[model samples]
Target: MKHKVILVVLDGLNDGVARHAMGHLQAYAAAGRAALYTLTCELPALSRPLYECILTGVAPIDSGIVHNNVSRLSHQRSVFHYAREAGLSTAAAAYHWVSELYNRSPFVISRDRHTEAPDFPIQYGHFYWNDHYPDSHLFADAEHLRVKHSPDFLLVHPMNIDDAGHKHGLDSAQYRNSARSADILLADYLQGWLDAGYQVLVTADHGMNNDRSHNGLLEEERQVPLFVLGDAFSFNPDVEPRQTELCGTVCALLGVAHDKPVCRDLLRPAV
Candidate 1:
């Protein structure tokens, strides 16, 4: 049977300390229903490039989206691309950078903020412009999209953790609290998504350092958490998945054919 997918990317959430802060996610990971892994982010550990990386399953060096400032519509086919091609609906309640990558370049808020164009890669989109946009609100927006569109592939990205990391160092209470707050927010909606038959993938693009910056080789900046919650995943994974494999994995769960590489080790035999 084909499964629907909801990919929730908590931008810039790290592997070590922040992991402890996300109580709801950790509980889900421990309950035996979800498979957890530590994903190694691609080089240049920046947001925009890694966003493209996670959605396109292509490395920065190869995609030429190596820098965050390189703003334009993606040239590579993404998970949304393949899902739409297979006659599946796709939607996103994410940051504007996502809109810039998939919907249009140099995002114009008036025209692109609340989009419902069937032809776009992200067919139904609700994009936020500022990093300060509340994670709680983003999740609500995602829920709205889910109820209204019932999209086959949904991308729900929240930026509060990353915004806090940039404003304060990773060691600060602010950063930790931001993660904790996100955990509380997830507690309100995750089970509903899963109960509704949406296989969930919660992960991060990259991590933040104590120095309050990324785009470096520090372990803290390179490693992030990946949690796959659904029957589609192997309950106990034996291999670490790369960030680039996300697109393919989502495609695989949605039964959409794609040319990208998937993290097959994480998948169950029936999937």
Candidate 2:
């Protein structure tokens, strides 16, 4: 059976430093409940470009969404589009940039903050406007969507880690604490989502650096972690996955047809 999927993108989370802070997620891996993989983000590791890359399997240069300020609708078809076209429900509790990418461009808070249109790529959305919008609140919003819509695919993207990184640098205590807090918050909903037959893929758009910035080639800026939960993933994955592989992986999880490149080895043969 094709399982429903929940993708949690923790913005600006560093693979190296965050591993030490995210003990709860580490424990889950240690206990054999999940598999951890490191994914290398594409060039110019900024959030918006990487977000589009992660969803459409197109690199920033190829898609022309090379920077965060490019604020326009995505031309490439995303997993949300693929899911909806395949007659599956899709929802997101994410940053407004997500809404801009999948639902509407230049998002208007009044008309676009809460949306439900079956024909839209993201059929249901609860988009937040603040960089400091609590991760706790974002997860709660995701849970609310799950309970209300039971969407076959859900995107939960939170920005607090990135916010902290931008304000205090990746090496600061605030950045570490933000990662720890997000891990604790995720622990609240993960098992329940898994029990409800949702395949969860938790990752980051990109990592952060000591200069309080990204969009560079530094290892600290390009490397992030992907945590695979539920039964869809292979503990012994045949090949490493990249950020661009996420779109097709998500479609594969939902049993939908898609043209994007996928990390086929990351999933079980039976899936």
Candidate 3:
């Protein structure tokens, strides 16, 4: 059977952070293909639009996702729609973003968004389900896969990094600490995939500026670090670090559509 592809979206993850620490990700890059490129979202490149671009391969204008808050519904089909509609099990470990859209899909694990801390559940590891969030759902799915019950596409996302970046400024220790946690969590997820014989892909919605601030149109806010953790993938990840090239590269890595990118593949191997 072909290996299922897992896409982990770490929001506001800069290329600098990924290059500087360079632990599990660097090793994974060495084995597989890694590319740092610009994942430029046209205008209003917030969470919903970014997710819209990622899932539909079209920018907000085309996908009808112009802002973070109002995205008109569509039956045109997306990764979530396709995977679930295809009889594949899909789970999202997302947080308080646009996670609600997956509720009606064929996805199994359900989660609800949480911005405040008191209501969130983490102690017993059992979260209220049938909700439509991503983080808790993804984490639990990974745990189940540890016992050989993984989903076809597991999407893990964390809000702490973006939360810290926006509230306390990107240069603060909060964002730095969140980055570290991202590394650690990524390591854990990849370990689970390796042990369970699954393929994994780690990337992000966009990059945050260490200098503080994300207006969404600038270069810093558009770039994202892309990495393929499994040994089955290979590429020259060290390319011209731009933000617009990520979508194509991601599609390529997933063996989806590498041929028709509005831009070129920034993650393509050096030949």
Candidate 4:
């Protein structure tokens, strides 16, 4: 059973930023198969719910996770849950959302030393340390978790760019610079993951514009990229033309079946 998946959710990342940082996502898209989808995210385009949706097969309406820190704790049966149910060593680190909300998740390289604490859960201030710091405690944790746990399902998140984009408009030089910085780090990590022959899934909750605003109703805000690399998945080489139908495309990439009950505006299978 060589089942393994890693989802990297680049928060507040827009199509423009993704294209600009093509050097980061391009290789994966070019050398392998990739798609883009127009998927709506939670209000304010925050990280919590979007990342949650990526984990659980449910939408905001179904997952009961609409706001940051609100109903996240209830999102217990995540993909990790499924993986663990299937008896795979599931693990997630870096993002407190991943470490805490999915407490039953198999492994975590978290600072949440109280993992053994009965009341332990994901805490934002402690996880992010607030104030948009440049340091990457999460990135380091991801590396540690991968090496130590070798989890079958891993989720890694880096937040400085999203933090900066939220503070300064997504189009601000500060945001793009932070985005590039993220790309640099991502390139190094992604390359190594591929070298190790691990299947990697790269995507975002939704697309954002420079003003750090999301239309949710428009393609500009909803359309985000998806890149699946390595030997674990398969997709058509003409994946580029199917970029906007992201939601279903991703399901296909990961071998999951899609069932959109409420978010009817979500992506559909490409014709």
Q: Which ten residues in a row have the lowest lDDT in candidate 2?
A: 230-239
Q: Is candidate 1 or 3 superior in lDDT?
A: 1
Q: TM-scores of the models, in the given order?
A: 0.98, 0.98, 0.71, 0.73
lDDT of each: 0.91, 0.91, 0.53, 0.55
Sort the predicted structures by TM-score, highest score first.
Answer: 1, 2, 4, 3
By TM-score, the better pick of 1 and 3 is 1
Question: In candidate 2, residue 183 scores what lDDT?
Answer: 94
Point out where model 4 deviates above 4 Å: 32-44, 69-72, 104-135, 213-218, 237-271
* lDDT tens per residue, model 3, 65-166: 667666345433455555544455555556433343434222224333321122211101122232223343456544653344355655666565676677
Scored by lDDT, model 1 comes in at 0.91
Per-residue accuracy of model 4 over 98-195 as CA lDDT, tens digit each: 56466634334454532323223321112333536443666666677677666555666666766776677765887778767777777767777766
Q: After superposition, which runs of candidate 1 have C-alpha atoms over 4 Å from their true positions? A: none
Off by over 4 Å in 2: none
**What is the Cα root-mean-square deviation between model 1 and the actual structure?**
0.9
* Cα lDDT over the full model 3: 0.53
Error of 2 at 227 (Å): 0.5
**Stretch of 10 with least lDDT, candidate 1:** 17-26
